[model samples]
Target: MRILYVGDAACLPEDLADYIGDMGDEWKVETVSDGNSAMFAVSNTTVDVIIVGPSLPDLAPPVLLGQIRTLRPETIRIALLQATEMGSTPSIRLIGVAHRLLPLPLASETVLEAIHSLEELRDLLDSPRLRRAIGRVEHLPSPPHLYFALTRALEEDEGNSGDIAQLVSGDPAIAAKVLQLCNSAFFSNGRAITDLRGAVTRLGLATLRDLVLASEVFSMKTGSNVDRAALQQRALLASRLAARILPRTSAELGATAALLADVGLLLPGVRDERQPLDPDGEPDERPGHTEAGAYLMGLWGLPMPIVEAVAFHRQPQRSSLRTFWVPGAVHVATALAGNEPVDEDYLKSLGVLNQLPAWREMAGLMSERIAEDAA
Candidate 1:
């Protein structure tokens, strides 16, 4: 992997060169002092990753990152953000431009770990054609304003269910979807939830936020061949079932992962990519919805666990996971919600086969309730 670091000598990690050297010839690093130099380097050579520091002499970090995005969209962009820079203009702009953000005064270990994760993701995805296709994609969905508002409300000290509900209610369409999902049999308790506050209280802040995000992103693409409404319903149901499968602590993350599992299907060119041809002229296996979705999440700078879970949700055996965690829960919930068979062999390998019956029971109840509602 070739990395281009755009910053002053002061901002670059002193040990970064040594670290890359230790990783062998597979890794290479190049440092440029200003935005002009960074642009020159990117335009001239193949850079797999670009790191922009908070302070740049010529062009601003955000501007430089934006140019990099346009010039080399496939290159992974990481920014070094100062603590005080949070909520600033450039920082806010970086939200869409940078793939990941790390603190300034960078620690080599943290940077290395982030790089390692990307390396692992590349290996797991293992399709240059898909990677380039996702890289060139310009119309990736942006999380709606409602998601940001909900996030801010959650961050406040006195934020509560009423506050969250009120924020959600400001957007009637989103509020209706939230309430609808909350009342679904997959998420519904014994009683109906009429008010937004009641629904928010039942769903919890994180899950509520995920629902809003999902609702708006799904709403963005209309008139496509894909039945987004039906797809959204299945994703929401899978999210609820995933939450049920996992322990309470990881439930919200699991739900988020499950909710966005099929997001790639919504993006243009993801489902339309042509399969690569082998030397023998046979068509090679193409990257599926899981990879395209995972690539999008990663580009959006979502948490790595959520990205990983989405990537491997369909094929858990492809991952190096011996124990059931977020990926496992998402896999089971997605399969169950879609009325597909679970990978019992994979579950048995992880020694979690005994738990399948309870999950199936949960799915069964969901199906029965849906049938009743439809009738």
Candidate 2:
């Protein structure tokens, strides 16, 4: 894997390069101080991954990344940033080009793990068949206004639950959707949810936020006649199950992690066939859905754990860090929702699943919930 790193941040880039190199002997990394040099390096050579800092002295990271995307449509791009930089304009632009955004105060092991996770993304970018399959689908959903409103709310001190709820209820479509969800068996505690305000008040801010995100991702319409509704139901069920299981594990933001884990599947580029380096499902190596989702999340300015949970859910054993159990829970939940049996043999193959005892109960409860909801 050849990585082109663009930034002036000496310590973070050097540390990240070292970590990538340690992950595999074949990993080749080169650093360019500015965006122009980084672009020159990429145009001249084949790079597997490109990592850029949000603030570059010569050129902004997002502008550089946008250029890189045009030049090398197939290359995996990531934005490297300090934690404080998240949600800023530069960060947003970086998110537009890159598939993953990594935070500083860097952990060596986590960096390596993220690099390994890129393998899955690389495989996807290399596929042509999957890209074509995805291309035929049209009208990918847009990000919900609720997400923007929530972020704005989080930014303001006056952004209380009531304010957030009022903001959300301001949109009739969103309000209807909220009422629909609340009335659905997913949340039907035997009472009807008549209003958006009541729905928000009952679900609380956190859960409502999660629901909004999940609804946006799941509502994507590819126009492929692929029964997106069923897929969305499966995804929703899996996410709900994962949320239930995450509390018992060490992960704190389990619901958020689970809900946004597979957003990559919604991207138009993932299925674009015209791109030469696009992923085709070949036997030797293929970019699976999880990898694509991780890459997309990275571009969306989501936190690292959410990205990791998306990328590594299919292969938790590959990750070095074990503090966040989202990937394992999502994996189990996805399998269960798909009506695929998850046994000890299956769990043992994925090391993280075997270590967690909550999986069985969670799976069972998920099954029951799905059945009850259907009924």
Candidate 3:
């Protein structure tokens, strides 16, 4: 795997590069000082991942991320910031935009973990069966116009809740989805959610934004007889589990990170194949559904953490220096939700499972939720 580390801090970038090399003999790492240089390098070469610092002199994190999405959409982009930086409003927005966000005070072990996660993601992307499965799902309705309007409003200095509400109300489908989600078991606020404006007020903008994305993705009526209901059930269960676990972490923006973890898999570009459940099937060399999902999310301008979570859920130990709880939680949640047995040896080899507390707690919670949803 080749990675481009973009940042102004010479020490941090070099340290990250060295860490990647030391952790995995397979990695080919490079470093750049700014977005322009990073962009130049990406255009000239194929990079598996790009890591950027939040405090770049040439470009803000959000702008750099947006440009990367437009230019080298396939390159997985991650942003590095101090733990304190995660709480700022700008940082929060950047978290919404970048592929993954890692806390500073970097350590070699953390860096290796994140890189390994990325490697797992790359492997998943190359899975031929998953790619074919994703191909069958039809394109969901594009809500880009709504997303644009909402994003613009959020960007405005004077943007108010009313403005966001009005924009959301402009699209009846979005409005209906908002109300539906707010009223569903997902929200479970005792009071009924009867109106779009009220739903927006109650859910808040960030949650609303994510919910809108989720609803749009789920609404796609793929004609395939594949277990669409089961997939959705697992996704919802994973999402809710993440939401529940995030508050326990000290990390800021943990909730948002957790909520968007599996979004990569839901993206249009990730190919999902409905194949026979045969363990003896021939291996595929092409990038699989997970990798396709990660690539597509990178294209769609999702925050790096969310993209990484989607891409690396299958293998969390391979990611860069951050112990991202989102992807970890998704792994546990998805397995539990699907009633799939955990392979302890396989997980231990990945190097992330032991870092987590016993899966029994998470697995039990996920099982209960899945059973309730089924009921």
Which one wins on TM-score? 3
lDDT of 3 by residue, 1-375 (tens): 787778856536446666666647878777788888887888887877778876777888778877886787666767787777655543445656565567777665655566665556655555566556555456633434565456566656446677777777887887887677777666645699787667778877766776665566556553434454556555666566666655443222334344444444444443343233446876544444455556556446555666666666565554543333566656555555555555454456656567445556765765665457548
Model 2 lDDT, residue 265, Cα: 52
Tell me each candidate's TM-score.
0.64, 0.60, 0.68
> Which pairs clash (backbone N, Cα, C closer than 3 Å) in model 1?
none
lDDT scores of the candidates, listed in order: 0.78, 0.63, 0.60
For model 1, how does the per-residue alpha-carbon lDDT over 1-375 read when each residue is reduced to its tens digit? 898888876877789889889989989988888999999999998999899888887888878988998899778788888866543433335645775667677777778776766566766565687777766666556657798677556545457778778888999998898778777766677688899888777777877898789878788852346778788878878988998898775687688889988877776655522123456765544456678888778666665668888988878776555457788999999999888879999999989999999999998887788778767
Q: After superposition, how far is residue 182 of candidate 2 from its true place, in Å?
A: 1.8
Q: How accurate is candidate 2 locally (lDDT)?
A: 0.63
- Candidate ranking (TM-score, best to worst): 3, 1, 2
lDDT of candidate 3 at residue 121, scale 0 to 100: 60
Native-to-model Cα distance after best TM-score fit, residue 295 in candidate 3, in Å = 5.0
Worst 10 residues of 1 by lDDT: 269-278
Predicted structure 3: lDDT:
0.60
